[model samples]
Target: MEFKRTNMCGELRSQDIGKSVVLMGWVGKKRNLGSLVFIDLRDKTGITQIVVREEDKDNYKKAREISQEYVIEVKGSVRERESKNSEIPTGDIEIVADKINILDSANTPPIYIKDDDDVSENLKLKYRYLDMRKPSVQKNLKLRSDIIRTAREYMYEHGFTEVETPFLTKPTPEGARDYVVPSRINEGKFYALPQSPQLLKQILMIGSLDRYFQVVKCFRDEDLRANRQPEFTQLDLEMSFANQDDVIEMNEGLIKELFDKYTDYDLELPIARMDYKEAMDSYGSDKPDLRYGYKIQNVSEIFKDSDFKVFSDNTLEGRSVRAINFKNLADKYSRKQLDKLTDFVKDYGLKGLSYIKYQEEIQSSIKKFLTDDILEKLKEALNLEDNDLVLIGADKDKTVLEGMGALRRKVAKDNDLYEKEYALCWVVNFPMFEYSEEEGRYVSQHHPFTMPNEEDIDLLLTEPGKVRTQAYDIVINGDEMGGGSVRINNSDLQEKVFEALNLTEEDIKNKFGFFIEALKYGTPPHAGLAYGLDRLIMLFAKTENIKDVIAFPKTQSATCPLSEAPSPIDDRALNELSIKLDKE
Candidate 1:
């Protein structure tokens, strides 16, 4: 190039007309019209139009050969465009080229660098570099960077010290499966990746750091989903001498700042709060989407004496019967569509779904089994209207809630029932432990280190099922953006929690001996929260798939199409680590 760059392709404007400028970027698009060649020069900021007249013979020849994604440099004078484009910021001006230099040539990209390109996700992952060149993808990445920077600034201003924790540590039981790495020096021993810096952050509080935070990577060898990845980032923080209110207040300020600075929407301070039990009973989900109303209502008592076996038997057996009224959607769903809904609930382990269509007449598949009085009572209980459809689930508590919860979201999405741009709520007072059928024992609902509700301490051994904890989750639009709890600063209380979880002395010593020992060193009354950075970015980016917010993300199968990781290792490498793969 003859000249050093003076401005980005997207930086030129009408005010810069008559000023000489040098711009460097990739050829976004090119068109030749015999006498003039027009090129859309693109950099990270955006794209700008550059024109080369045939009168400038040498530059015109070079512009004619320019293709999409070709790296180039141009020295030109900015001029007001003859046709102003209201779409782009740089549309009011054009760069008249006095010089053009192609830095590199390129073959055609496998995927188009456009937001609406309808290509397979696999293809996008395979050519992610090209995919990232799209303005939309770049915008998402840029926003992610801005959010992280804002988070760091907020934490620092709040007297929180940024800290780094180990990526490799001793393997511990509970939570999700860990991605383990064999220690070459230790032979058969392996080190597990940190699921979260839960233990380390608590120890920092004990170490008297007072306040600590980290924007770090964590790994979990778990099944993939739309909002899940094998490895992801988290904004983890812990504060000593902080209670539940303190933690919530600090995070609320940070969230408010982020939204106000980056988004057009303003978040109301001190977001709404809901009890965990109320959330589940009303919305059938711990992380309930509050943007729209389709609240699940418990109708078990109303149906206790009903003739319908599905309803009566479950109610009589201490199970549940829940109903959701999809207002004025009776005609929207036909018999075939209702049957499809039944199949959807079946996927959640419900035997089937029962519904009542209230159109000109009250009609239901189970109407024959119900008496007129029972039907009338049900209609009143659900507040059914002339054109409303009520879907019902009857089963064990968990099954019923799961089925109805899924149906609520699905129906809302299918019918375009979203009423708000964002709904943020805090779900508090979660159960400390839940029965794990596979383990035939109780496991921590949040984690073993969580402090139980003080009043429920006696119930830990007496009525373990009734014990609640000081845990809280921040749910936004049906997704759990983050969750945390007051830690068990008392070693004795922590031991009792482990006992309730049925962790034997030996199990406790092996898995959490270090953490328990650390607590003995006068751990402060501390609480912290860790936000799923990817999930938070997803919400801000308005993207359904988590990968859209991530620069290089794995596919649903947990494999990187671009790098093709998780491939077979050489035998010699395994031998160095004293490891061998089990061949079936």
Candidate 2:
């Protein structure tokens, strides 16, 4: 018999009543009585109920034999369901089967094919093809597609040309480690996957592409975390003769469109901006969630003259104290719970945690150490009220901010303190260089090509640590959604940035030789940004697990459960590539 789908299972509704429709999908489930059978047919869109009555003997017989996940085609007339299911989209209508074709049968699946199945991630990933059939999973993938299409369409309308850069390119000097592929004919040489197309995009600007964009794959052979993968997609973009303002302006439209299309919040254009230093000082995070009002407050002055040595010592130069008020959560946290909070900050390098319970009677961890005068001052600084809990961290500025910032976020999450669903802002004016303690040198905060602020350019060599870059990041709900910086178009300035990193002439020639050469060929003042496509989708999809947004994501250990990827290659294939395993 000929098989063709006249309509999707989920799209049929009461309006299509009495219309003959051909539907092909997997059997979501089957309910069989002695006379009748009701089967829920599922496609990627959704599930629709199909009724096979005893009167239609042949169809009823075939439907009765159907089991879960069995692929089948049905010829039926749409009819209003007497019993409506408010839960599903196609609940109002169902097909009354006249003909049925059981195309294939499926054995019991390893995992249930349903949303909210609550199976372990490994099992879901192992049977990813089946997992994707779930409506919830399919919706995320669909949203991912919509976002990419929106981005592409926006770029095209804005005169940006989509260009495909090579996947196998030279490794960059800055950022994460690269995933390298060994070359067969080139003996020991290898090709490192492009980390961000950072150099290539700038080279395009030099080549006068003017406006370039790529939905590119980037690989990083670094330690994987929950949201991070060994390989990920980047919405890579760059523009020539553009500054930070131009880049941000153009991107704001696309970002606004995405938010406006996907979210209910009315996002205002030219989204608010916060300086990097201000963000760190105010929230202890470069990417701060502005949805709530637990802003980090500097309380160093409150303990400046205190007898407590810990508070006084940190209140000195290069050290400081900070605090956050968990509004009305004081009595809620017991001593043991407070101890747990203390244990949490230890990972951030705090020796201890100090907190105040501003209840009927003011109680504090440092009650014995501080005079009542200092306590009063601290209360004033944090705007103390009844039932308030103030958590304080005192150390060097970096340690205090980071520790307190982390505590701030943790408290908000633990106590259900988030006031809004989405909070976004532009974090601008990042430091040009950050000192890497392990490397014992300054590295680019964004990348080597980042152009320093006009005034800060003079401070680049003299006060490299203080120099600010013309860089910006679009931070959404405390995640760095996307970031970019103006490129150092002049070859001499580019070489100087390398010099500031203490790179030897040989290091410069080998690592960035081609990029430096490209800069010499009339490079334009270009800037670009790349969004973590997966993270963006995860945010809009409202899923905390990044794997929820990816189709076949790898585990935190960077291995794919579906294909058993990273499996060993045959020894003959290894030999052909001139590779040998040390296994040491």
lDDT of 1: 0.92
List candidate 1 segments past 4 Å from native: none
| Candidate 1 local Cα displacement, residue 100, angstroms | 0.9
RMSD of 1: 1.2
Candidate 1 residue-wise lDDT, 270-359, digit = tens: 998899999988888999999999899998988888788888999999999999999999889989999999999999999989888887
Query: In model 2, which regions exceed 4 Å deviation?
Result: none
- lDDT per residue for candidate 2 within 14-51, as digits (tens), equals 78888999999999888887676889999987889999
TM, every model: 0.98, 0.98
Q: Residue 189 of candidate 2: its Cα lDDT?
A: 91
